[model samples]
Target: MIPFHFTGARVLRPGGLIETPVGITEGRIVDAPCGRAVDASGFLLLPGIVDPHGDGFERHLAPRRGAMLDMGDGLAMLAVELAANGITTAMLAQFWSWEGGMRGPDFARAMLEAHAAVAPLQAVDLRVQLRVESHLLDDFDAIAACVERFGVGYVVFNDHLPHRQLSEGRKPPRLTGQALKSGRSPEAHLALMQALHQRSAEVGPAVAALVARLPGVRFGSHDDDSAERRAFWRALGAGISEFPETLEAAQAAVAAGEPVIMGAPNVVRGASHAGKVSAQALIGQGLCAALASDYHYPAPRQGALKLAETMGLEAAWALVSDGPARVLGMTDRGRIEAGLRADLLLLDPETGRVGATVAGGRLAYLGPEMASRFFG
Candidate 1:
């Protein structure tokens, strides 16, 4: 049993939050006091940010104009960066495309092994979001095995139709921005994308069946453009709309009980880098249930601040903590309650940067000097 108190902090309790000290015993929040003894003073005690999707792309994992980093190095870099950002849980959104060719395969294989090796040594909670690109349907066999072996919690349905998204009359470009990041030559990338498109049209029922067959995994559909389009696949057990491109698709997701997952960068920046609906509108309507960091590492934490700043503190915190927790089926940890796990974060209420992080009854992140006292 571990007992500690956080005084003068905003303790976000089940019913509501109060400026008080929280008591922890056996990793459970057993009590809270009106006038605290231990001085929390100015710390913001909030739930650890639950990131549904975001990858190591920023670490040159998917280098846009520069060289790619070693997979291990990328993961290591991301671990430290995210914890500091106040993200307690992260889902590394790995994009695997058959048209992606050799690099995709190499990165996927290496990252899986790297995940296994790094957890014991790392301080943060990192999870995997396997973004299965539909164009790469041919690699279904290899992918099924990977999901079974890895604890990839989220599986996304991504079909990037190159010829369709490009200029209507022109031949598909040899390499798009995404392909360049993957280090494929334009000609090779175009060829791979085209082949994958053909393979998708072939539309092997086997691939769809395999997707449904994979257990212990939740299904997410990416870049949903319309409600009709979104529903067609949700009927097939696809429960997540990763980046709904339009209001109708987002509404469609809500009506069907599927959560809408948008990028935090989109919400904070007021627009999508890709041409998509505004995240701000989605959040205003309560249409958005979760916010993933996406390609930006600090967006999740910053997004929370932006939300609180724009909408109000109580509401903004709800989006980052309670909203995402409910969507992910993580009821216990998201809201501060008596019986929930002690996965929590301490940040400055004014600024959103995470100052300390706790997970599974252990203080995972602390200041450089006190680190010894907690981890000692």
Candidate 2:
């Protein structure tokens, strides 16, 4: 990678945007100029986005429901999208659920192995977040083995089963669709849900025990709906709250000093598609600590820009960059400061599009508008 002396852009710093020349050499930001001189008078130099949670890579991994045989190509394509969207560091959320096909335990293990193999070759720093289904007690040992073997540091507990319908012996909505997706018959899927629901008493203790086993792993709760649910996960040593479904849960997590992660799409869409608490509302109340891309890679950048309309660019941008880096306990690349990793983006102020992206002091992406500036 060629070292760079970036001049003429309004650089975003911890204080605010400033007309300062930034330098990058050997993958770290520096004070003095290095190798090449680049004129960037028309762009906004910002830190490369650090996305905490996103599953948009799933489509690239299996675009047509098992159409992809090799994971490397899909991951390579995913990296291009990440860089194009100005994402430098991303946590790819993979599922260890009862759902078969792409989301099964087998698929999770394969994905983890493939990610480990492909990460070294990509410029974007890609990490995996294993989403464990709480009711899958039989797979606890396998999950632990995978975590240990793969060095997975982040884990989130999820319970997507419709316990209410299953407990009442009623058919859950979308039962047929889900069953077909999982390659299971509707009757078998319903029976499995019922079995898992019947063992509800065992799940809490089992999850707590699993959490205890993974001492070094960062734990979080997914889709927390109430204060009690948040408290339950917190009591189990989960420190992060991912997408609290209601205001009460968000407030409870904030009051408990846990970082609350909201979907960036919620802020962009102005509301939750699932009829849950609005992310913008939570951000206004100071309850949200970070905004995750969730299922959409473009939402993080778009969401922050939207919030910048009122919260100021610095604060809104922090929700996607510094805030998420803090949530992940990564102190290396979120801020554009000396001695930190040189992960950055050059955005066109007029159109709000990324003109170029630099990750680890290497040019990861270059848009058409900025191509001539770098080459000509």
Candidate 3:
């Protein structure tokens, strides 16, 4: 890789943005320039986005029903989108649920294998985060084995089953649509949900045991809706809270010293589409630790910039960068400092669009406007 000196841009640092020339060499930020100088006079150099959880790659993997032919190629295409969105390190959230199609255990395994094979060839650093259905007790052992086999470090527990509706012997909303996606008849899907709902008593212990088995992996709870729900997961050694649906859940997680991750869409939209707690509200109360892309790759950048309207760019950007890096236990990237991995984004100050992106000191994306600065 060729080294480059980025000059004249307002580089975002731990303190704030400053008119400091940045140097990158051998995939690390350096104090002295070692290669060609690039005049980034009109750009705002900031840390590349570090997205903790996003499943937008699912679209590329299976663009149509039963259309998942080549996962490697899909992942290759996903990398371009990640780079274009200025995401350096991203956790591709894949579901290991009872759902039989793209989100099933089989599809999750294939996605992990494909990512392992194709990530090395991409400029962005891609990792997998398995979103396991908490009530899938029958598959806990298999999930553990898959995690070990793929060297997956992050896992989040999810419970999407409509327990209330099932307990009341009522049909859940969208049952038919969900059943079709899972390749099951409506009757079979309802039966499965009822069966899983009946085993709710077993899920807590089973999930705790699974966490005990994977001592080295990071565990989190998703869509926590109450303080008790957050506490239950925290007691099971799951320290991270991903997208707490209520302010109570978020506050509980934060009070427990666990990092609370909210969806970037929630921040950008100023409210949750599901009518849950507002991410902006949580941010205002100092309950949120980081922001994840959720299902949109561009959201983190847009969310942070939107937040910069009030909190200042440095603190708001941290939610998408250093905060998430810390949540995932990654110490190498997410900051524009000497001796760190050179993961960076250059944005147009006037329009706030990403002009260029560099991941691990390699040029990942260069917009047409920024081409002359690098090549001329």
Question: In candidate 2, what are the lDDT values of residues 1-376, reduced to their tens digit?
Answer: 6787899999999999998889999899997777888989989999999999999999998989659999988998899899999999999999999987788988898899899899888888999999999999989999998999998989999999998887777899999999999889999988888888888889888888998998889999999999999998998888899999999999999999999999999999999999999999999999999999999999999999999999999999999999999999999978999999999999887888899999898888999877888998
Ranking by lDDT: 2, 3, 1
TM-score, model 2 to reference? 0.98
Candidate 1: which stretches are off by over 4 Å? Answer: 1-3, 25-28, 32-38, 57-70, 99-103, 165-169, 174-186, 368-376
lDDT of 3 by residue, 51-144 (tens): 9999999899999966878999999999889988899999999999997798898888889889889999988999999999999899999999
lDDT of each: 0.72, 0.92, 0.92
Per-residue error (Å), model 2, residue 46: 0.5
Q: Under the 3 Å rule for N, CA and C atoms, how many clashes does model 2 have?
A: 0
Model 1, C-alpha of 217: deviation from truth (Å): 1.2
Evaluation by TM-score, superior candidate among 1 and 2: 2
The candidate 3 region of ten consecutive residues with least summed lDDT is 30-39
